[model samples]
Target chain A: MSSFRVVLGFELKEYFRSKGFMITTFLIAIIAVVGLSIPRFIDLGFNRSEEGSSSREFVTDNSRVIIYDRMGYLPPDELLQAYSNFQYAGSEKEVEEAVSEGSADKGFVITGPTSFKSYIYNADMFADEGAQIGRLLSYGKARKYASENNIDFEQFKQTLNPEISSESVILGKDTRGNYWYCYALVIIIFMMIIMYGQMIATSVTSEKSNRSVEVLVTTTNPNSLLFGKVIAGAIASLFQMSVILCAAVLTYRVNREAWGGLLDMFLNIPLRVLGIFLLFGLFGYLFYAFIYGAIGALVSRTEDISRSASGVMMVIMVVYFATLFQLSNPDGIVIKVLSFLPISSYSAMFARVALGTVTLVEVIVSFAVLLISVFLAGFLAAKIYRMGTLRYGNPIKLGVALKTIRRAKKQAKKLAKEQAKEGIETANEDREER
Target chain B: MLLEVKDLVKSFGDTEVLHGISFSAESGTALGLLGRNGAGKTTTIRILMDVFRADSGEITLDGNPFSAGDHWIGYLPEERGLYPKKKVCEQMVYLARLRGIHKTKAMENVDYWLDRLEISEYKNEKLEKLSKGNQQKVQLAATLVANPEIVILDEPFSGLDPVNAQLLKDVLNEMIAEGKIVIFSSHQMPLVEEFCDDIVILNHGDVVVSGRLKDIKKEYGENRLILSSDNYSMPELRKVLESQMSDIVKIDKEKKNFFVLEQKPKVTRERILGRLLNSSVKIEKFGVFEPSLSDIFVAKAGDEYE
Candidate 1:
């Protein structure tokens, strides 16, 4: 086991020093950083477009200025300034020239002698992007009603419209930035967890393909070596994730205003979710890595890595779909089952935590199930790995693999029995010889 | 007391691959394990190396059952493997590191072996870029880089040219000369006869023959003799030899000699040698022949090659 640790560290160092490893890490990290930063740059440009909110208002409607004066919504000085921007022009081209030549952002038109609808509906009036044109036509209709019935605009406001207010309540503890943050965290965790699990698989595959396991297995128990591999993979993943996270956190903090409340979400989430992620990450590693180890053992060449890894990868893809379904309907049967199952649990449980949907008791129960499943999978995988490592020329069949395990168990039992019998017989023989 | 494999029984699924096989090798002795394909030579090697577990057996070392967590044995499996994408020295050093050797010392050993094999130029070159023979040398170096005390190699001469094979043969000889316990498997019987003193030949998952190679070959006691005379064609001598001996099992007029095999029970070599010594049949040369390992295997295993 200790020797395995040494080998693992050597493996990590080898990858870390490799141009491939360094180059890959560098590329991914740079992409992640640039991906985060590019949005801020684009958002900055968008914010510049919204800077018009600070533009000084030029009241473009002459009638609106008079109404504003009566309503006291504007002061006398402001009302007088509104008359300068709002005016009746002879032709529509003059109105367009006024708006388009940086004189105003909007313009108002007043009807002459006909009904207000005819004047407002004319193509000549400059109405805001689209809705402003409809509002101008509707204003003409309201003005006719005001003139014929002797009703004022203030009375219209009082009798015709009621202010509506909305108050939406959240039932559960709200983690700030729940969706975006949750998604980022989930995606990062998901992608990286897959990567680490595959790392274990590929490493084991390489060893088996190269027949290096023959030398290692000669002196060490397979279990100890596997334990070492599992631990190494987890550590490697965590180490890499932490480095990238640190870089991201540092970068985001530099753009604090845009990413404000980012740390708030981290602080508010229950410490229990962290525990869930770790527990889930662990089982995920074992469940996925052991199966990979088994596949790797069966392969005699690098080409076999592709074929065998796909089988394991299919299971992962299914788990991914299960996670997505869990995200959509967390309490559904499929989602519930996957949440409690070892491999799917990592994905589903993380999603549930992000959604603030899972209970502590549920998490504990799911974890318990996961732990047991991991042990079982590990044991089975070990048997398969042991058998697969020695087999070549043809893929070892499932039936053959099961029988091999059974035969080994039976052989072990028989061997123990014979040892016991020999012990007694040797004792008796020793007495007789003595 | 160096190594012991007692009643090693293994089966692949329902079929037995090695049935209660047993053999031992003392320290400094090279034991040749002989078998054709699918005869469980690789299985036996794997079982001994702990890559495969025996159905029923115990492997002990120096009077104690070997603990499973000790990385002290060096094993070269039947498949020759190294990272083809890696440099020769780098791959060798990495393999050595796996066996608990420090990088610096491993590098030194890598340099030593590369120079010894006269392939030092390939040290900094990727193994894939090298020729097949060079790749084999890299694999050979990986096997001994850790300098293990117990070495088990399976089919170590699979892809080597004759010269490269001799180079590896010399390395194995050197390892044995250093008081190491060596066990190897090969179908090249002559090399086995030259390098390994003792052997165990398996056929159809059973040990058909196991002993000192010379003694095992000697056990098949039908002595062979070859002779030729300028005065007589091989066919003419065959007729006369048939008259001289009743135990003639096989007769062949090969390119260089007239060969004859006689069963020991029916006629003694002393009688034949006397006939040759006294006869005026102008003899070119006559000599007794030793049975080969292949002949011993054929006699013991018969047609059950698998």
Candidate 2:
């Protein structure tokens, strides 16, 4: 326990003092803030300039229909006045000129008392406010005709507004937004584990190459040292990630209006989903940290660190790409199997839960598998570490190292038993003599 | 015996490196663990430090199982290493703390050792920035910062100039004065002769010769006799010594009519002096010289010493 504390304190001190650590945290915070603020800043810039200078634009805000009396059929001023926010023009050329000069949003020419030709910016006439006005005017004409024919306006209005109600239900999946939110969380967790796992490996390799492990191992248990270093790395990474996450949330909060309901994407996520993300993320990092440290110990020099770490990286990559591919097919058989795999489960199982296609039992079983696997990895890595650190030369293959570790353990056990037997024999002889 | 190693065996893969090596060192004495390359001196020290496990062996300290943590065994491996980028005092404090010293005490010890080594000014300086000799002093300081009960130094004098070597020698003498079991390994034979009270000579992973330094020299007996004469040409003295002493194996000429006669069976210094006086070769200085640790090491281990 004291050795653990010593190694932990030393590792933390080194990590905290490192310029790389400080700079990376600061840079990540900056990036997060910038990522959240850029869209809001752009929106503010557009809103401020456009809103301040455009009263005429506001005139067009409510359809600003320029009606050209081409047929001279609209001589009724009261009728035009009753239709609020409608612009009227005398000649077709005048309305055409107004529409062409961008002063009006749309224009119209009344060919007859009940019909008219409409002008719009694009073919999406339903989207144009002026087109709505044209439709409303045509409806009014028909309503007027109906009144003259003694028809009920209430029933006609009721025809325009229906009372039917309907609801949407996805059979076995969550909302699309929640699915994407879960996927985003999974990707972040995956990247974090990979990045920090590499850091742990590199740190261990540096210690070994520097030959500090010799002094360290002699003074303390290698297993305790390994655990302490791994924990330190995990804590450091989580601290940095939290800082960046907080920065992002703060930036979004400050520009809440500009986010335009983007926060809702995350807010709607169930708190339990976030809890699962955290749980799986922690176990995943622990699992990879042990493997990385063990691999790091196998190497004799700094140059071999990356090569030694490549195997672990490959496993991580497989999990990552497979998870990504399963994102679209979250309920597929491939993902179902992948969710049970200790490595991929951190991502795949959480994703399945987020998609609302996974059961609690599945999550518990997967999490249990991962937790047990992490403990086993830590144990095996420590064994490998104890053996690998003392042997220096070419990088030891993992197979060879494991075999040596097994033999060493057996030898240690045999030695212990013999020592115990010897102690017992000596005790028996002494007792008899007495 | 403060530290006793018995029949330690170590093997790597199919081959055995250390073949039943055994030795012991007492408190307040410096044991020179002498060996050539691949002589298993390092392997043995590593096992003692508990960096590597021996295949089979028993090490006891004061009749108790000598664990790695039995005492703060200060070790300076032949492959001298430290965090080159770390400050001198910081790494020293860290290492001292690893040996179970408290933080504040570790800091104080670091300061004391740095000051004693005359490197207080470079306490906060990165080890890489220090001169090679000063760096060596810092390494030595690190090794002694914990005030270890048993200290193992392998080739501690390597890469050091004569002045720095003397500085290290003085520090080691201080360790001996403190009653520390200092196990030193070095290729500089004269330095070993000066530092070691007990000697273990390893040849090809085997303990070829080991005992109290004085006893080993005595048991081997004084095989080389040196004679410095005033009036005698080289040919004349050679003829006189050769004709009388048939046991003389080799005669090496030194400067100013000095000659060293290697004898198979020990010859009394007085008898040689009588013969020289009878031959009219007036002796200026005559003494039976005990073989040096290096000579003994070479004679026992053969021509493998580099």
Candidate 3:
């Protein structure tokens, strides 16, 4: 086997043998399974009894509502449409007394046709009982007006609230339908990059701090060690993410009917969009992981990792927030520009593919650019890793390391040119002698 | 097989560490690389192992250019370490596999080295759980698990008890007997002198002394004699020698048991002995002096001692 394979195998074994890794993966998967299966065990009230209905009757037992229609605009039967149990009170004082005495859950006094007074023993932040009573009073006034004019009440109601039958056919991407999953995928990629990037950096720094890097560098090339470590980290994180996501997706698919398709926008993802997400996400992760690995080698202690990798972390954070904010406007100029850049393209391009229009040529070019950046980052990381292996003290600056590599490259070119000139001269001498 | 390094020049940025130093080691023999701290020994070894490219140099195996990747080189670095949280056998096999050994063969090699080093029972234990001496043994096992053709040991005898040191000595002797080129680096001169046939002493990145151990000792020991008298103490012997042999020899060193004398120019050991016998001090021990490796090292590299 090649050295890269050997290193990769060893790193993978380390991750597999870690208890923290195994428990975290298993626990997240369980959480996903349970979270997706919640609708089956409890009624979330997303199911409607009849199709094309505007509202459903409140089904709570022992829940009472007291109403005092001062203007007599709302009928008790019409108020009953908003709540199943309604107590008609002659005075506002009676309505307030019933609510305060805990005999009623809520009380509404219609002081005017469009306005009302509400009373409750305890107010809930999400309660809309007053609004419901106001709507009912308005409808009752419309009915009373129709009766006085000798118009058909049903025809008047139909004229006021007409139902139009329409079907929405999306010719392009459905942003509303695909929004949740795209948001979820963007967060997933961002989290993977941060978590696994730190892991790769920590691994490298620990090896350096413990002095194991000396033996490692001698046993295998730095390129093999770095690339193997990064790839192994990526695979480990990808495995965990796949398990959790698959658990949620499969459980929801099995229970889609039980959920009444409520979570379809978040869980039912298109395979093509998912494919783009995987490809771009993997490349972006590798790009950052290589840089993290190089930063790891620059530090001599594990404590220095955070300080050294802060720059990369900042860039990742910027990309994460930018992609989230651009989800609603995937085809805007900002996202269009970011989609082609390797740093933000992992999420920006995926967002465009899911919710916005994108051409195949644009995707191909963006992917190619990202792939090349990954390779470049890997090569640079390997060089820096090799240079920083034996050095131990304060952490080396990234700028200084880059300068050194550039200078070395220039020196190597000069040396090669000198050697070529010497070879030519030696050949000329030999020819003349012959 | 012969491994030769010639004109190795290495620099780190503005400061040059190794300045065109050269040495050679052959199969079935051990070469001792002696140097004080910061004497560029590790730097040179790293260059030979391809950890760092030399600014300019020629390294060869037999007659062809040498690439460290093409050969299995067991390097026990001075800064010794393995994965502290990993099982001993697991990491040993990993290191061996990195050197191109297959899994089955790697496992076999790890078992063999662990058994040979008497740490077979601890093979499944984490490295951090082992005692320091046992950890050093595991490190040695890691170095030799690939059955490398060349073995480079830096301070291998450190942190070892007499018994463990003897075990390591026996293993090294066996490696040399099997015709493996062993480059032993240590500050413990006695251990190097015990097994090394050749030595190169580096001081400030310069080779101060390089040759066969026998020849270097012979060259340093010439015209020097050790004498001890039973009738008098070293001070008394020194006094007598100053009075009677002042014309023939000069007292170089005075110890509690013996006195070392340097002969005058063109003087012989026999002449010094004749002069010592004629003195009133009774002769107890008299012989031509053979310098120890430590003595030679101090003589050559002592000026820059911190």
For model 3, the stretches where C-alpha displacement exceeds 4 angstroms are A48-74, A77-81, A84-107, A119-129, A143-156, A410-434, B304-306
Sorted on DockQ, best first, the list reads: 3, 2, 1
**Cα lDDT of model 1 by residue, B1-306, tens digit:** 468778888876688888888888887889988877888888888777766667787777885666434646667777766666667887777667666777799899899888877799988998889988788777777778888887888888888889988888898899899889989998887788788888988887888888888777666643666677778887777776677654533453243455645545466666767767686567787666567776666666657543
Model 1 — interface RMS deviation? 2.8
Candidate 2: DockQ? 0.58
Q: Is candidate 1 or candidate 2 better by TM-score?
A: 2
For candidate 3, write residues B1-306 as lDDT tens digits.
999998888898789999999999999999999999999888888888877777776688996768887889999998888899989999999999998889999999998999999999999999999999999999999999999999998889999998999999999999999999999778989989999999999999899999899999999988788889889887777888888888998888665699878889988877777766776878998888889998899988887552
Superposed model 2: Cα runs more than 4 Å off:
A44-175, A327-333, A357-362, A390-393, A414-434, B247-257, B262-272, B280-282, B304-306
Restricted to chain B, the TM-score per model reads 0.88, 0.87, 0.95
Error of 1 at A153 (Å): 9.4
Show the lowest summed lDDT stretch of 10 residues, model 2 chain B.
B248-257
Residue B254 in candidate 3 has what lDDT? 67
lDDT of 1 by residue, A1-434 (tens): 55676656656665666677667666767766776575466654323324333453232333321111111222334334434434344555555565566454444333332212112223445543324333444455555677789889657845665556698686774544454444455566567656766676677667666655665555455665665665666666677777677766666656545443334454344566666666686677667767665665556665656666776678777877667645656556777778777777876776677664667898889888888877776667666766666566555655677887797788778977886787689789999999
Question: Please, what are the lDDT tens digits per residue for candidate 3 over residues A377-406?
Answer: 888888888888788999999999898788
Poorest 10 consecutive residues by lDDT, candidate 3 chain A: A52-61
Error of 1 at A411 (Å): 2.0
User: Considering summed lDDT, which 10 consecutive residues are worst modelled in model 3 chain B?
Assistant: B270-279
